[model samples]
Target: MNNENIIDIIYGNLGSMTATDQKVAHAVLTAPKDAVNYTISELAKVAQVSEASISRFCKNLDLTGFHQLKIQLAKVADDESSYYDEINIDDVQQALTNIKNNKVAEISNTLASFTTPTLKKIMALINHARILQIAAEGNTYPVVADAIYRFNQIGILAIGAESWSTSIGQTLNLITDDVLMIISNSGESKALLKQIDVAHKQGMQVIAITNRKDSPIALKADQHLRTSVRQYVLNSDYYFSRVAAITAIETLFLLLIAENRKRLSAIQNHENIISTDKI
Candidate 1:
């Protein structure tokens, strides 16, 4: 019952949340430690909402009551406060240990954030689409390319558009039967946002895989699959976001193959042909 899990739940549900609930969520996210200490009445006052709204918010997050939320928040506060307290960057062993721990935590958090119903919807869209296009830029481009490769290996028709103009051109031709899967860690890239706008206006459905569920691109897409994990280290020069995003993409690829025998057969056939040619 880590509050990080609760925080992820709040973010994952932000698209469908009421304004009041959003206020409560924001208040907690901004200062989880403080929130843990606040009575329901204090939190209500701080968030500028009624106590009933706070109770409803807890229930929405599947917590039985406000007390349970506080318990989770207290644990999270303790963990967060101590997460980096012992780290010594000059010590190689300590640095490597810290890095490994952070990566493991991030992957676990990303996995906990996934919703089965949303994943099923994404699988269904990919299965039924007349065409599947992936849009991404910068560091995210490789992930999109990998997804395209994986889909093609299973006999699924998929393409990747990495540049702004290419994405625009690809999205322009997309019809209602086509699906565009956009990968962006921040989900706020100017280029991707433009394409998302075009895709929506052109009557095409969009699926967004991003770290921030509340980001503009996620909000614009027809369905959003969120990746939980913030970038870490070295003045933001190092990023762990890709690890989580790629993990999600691979999970989808595996699930697609699992649910479709034809896809698996296609992959096996391709392998067999390659083996025979090599022989």
Candidate 2:
């Protein structure tokens, strides 16, 4: 059983235990591995309860003696390698499902969290932008390119920062009419942060899309759209966060397009006229 199941078991048996036994229960719940390494007297002393409470805890878990219970817990520690191997497989599926759920939830959350003031800020920047640029590194770079497509189709002069030096140079020369939307998962990329800072100094609007709410990039952004991705095990991989990031960018693209439908229609009409004349 997992820590959650262990917690459930303790709570389920709560009514049967005395006040002192409850103290032991609380300690075990608070620090199970620590409790596993503690002796009966040591636990009772720490919990400010009696030794009998520790003995009762073992009984509560269906073990005959405290030593046997400790041995079982030790076995659990020993079996962790196999348990986690199976968990990785299960967690991959769980992470995938979580990404799907989180992607939908993020769209809803971002829409709900969005405000008129923020929209006006972004709209003003986009409306007058001479060259709207988006920069992202690693796994998130594709999202930036996709966003550029939507921006260009809607008649905005938008492009992706495909190279680091190019991104920095483009950002350095940005005027008051430029806009930069930077996407990063960890939000700690040095190059991206430097680009954002330079853009801000150069009078360009900077927007951020990231999973970490507390990241420096999010803090530095003129506007932030935060995304959340679930990590099943320890969050060492990038399965869920990438999906969340992609979905956020797509949602932003759709919303921006919807907001500028009149301009988009005018552009389409012009294109249609030119195509007909050519034919």
Candidate 3:
């Protein structure tokens, strides 16, 4: 079996292993490729187990400390037997179930690495902004649109305009009190970057949701919510990261909305008062 298969076996039978082996097994399962590059000491520390236990774990797989285990795993990862191409047609239920699992894993990882300070900053931005605008292009548009909807639901002066010129027009009177959240997976969209530059120049707080941390949009944004996606060819039929990015945006919006629950309730109550007065 290939290293991935072996890793799966290790994961599956983890509870059966000795307590020390379980630590090593968990580390490998979480990040097999990264584990290959770690030294014995590094791996042992990461696994929270001793070096001697690590060597014993490798021996369980018929290898030596860190290096030989890495070589074997690398060979398996590089081998053709481990490669699987996307199948266009599949049973709908099976496909959806697997996709759901993938999304859960991606969000879990994203949340784990998420910095608390970043979240606190985003929440502060939402709380203090006079207006919040979400702008996006291509598939990213859906995420921004949803954010705008959430903002409106809570009576925030939020806007998400689809067309390029309209968004620019809307931003003409922008001030530092405004905040802009831009969503782009690739972070290479020229128009979006230009708009972000405009917002920044006007002293607005710009937040970027993108996969590319080093992309121009990220550099220009006042804040960033970085998401990780598997690199694939441009023409690749099945793109897996769209949902992950969307989930990140949704999470951010939910957090912001939840944080402002009292304010939202007050806004609704005022609107209700006005409606009753008119009636």
Per-residue lDDT of model 1, residues 1-279, tens digit only: 333455555544554568888788767866788888999999999989999999999997778999998987776665552222224578989877776775665567777767899989999999888889998889778888888988888887998766768778988888988899998877778888888888888788899988776678988898987786533345312243577788888888899878977788888887887897784
Between candidates 2 and 3, which one is better according to TM-score? 3
- On a 0 to 100 scale, what is the lDDT of residue 160 in model 2? 73
TM agreement with the true structure for every prediction: 0.70, 0.57, 0.62
RMSD of each: 7.2, 14.0, 12.6
lDDT of 2 by residue, 85-146 (tens): 21234578885655556455444444444557876677777777899989998777887787
TM-score of candidate 2 to 2 decimals: 0.57
The best candidate in terms of TM-score:
1
The C-alpha stretches of model 3 lying farther than 4 A from their native spots are 1-93, 230-241, 263-279
Clashing residue pairs in candidate 3 (N, C-alpha, C atoms within 3 angstroms) = none
User: After aligning candidate 2 to the native by TM-score, how far in Å is the CA of 234 from where it should be?
Assistant: 8.9
lDDT for 168 in candidate 2 is: 86
Best by lDDT: 1
> Considering lDDT, which of the candidate structures 1 and 2 is the better prediction for this target?
1
The local lDDT score (0 to 100) that residue 266 gets in candidate 1 is: 89
lDDT against the true structure, per candidate, is: 0.77, 0.66, 0.68
Which candidate model has the greater lDDT, 1 or 3?
Answer: 1
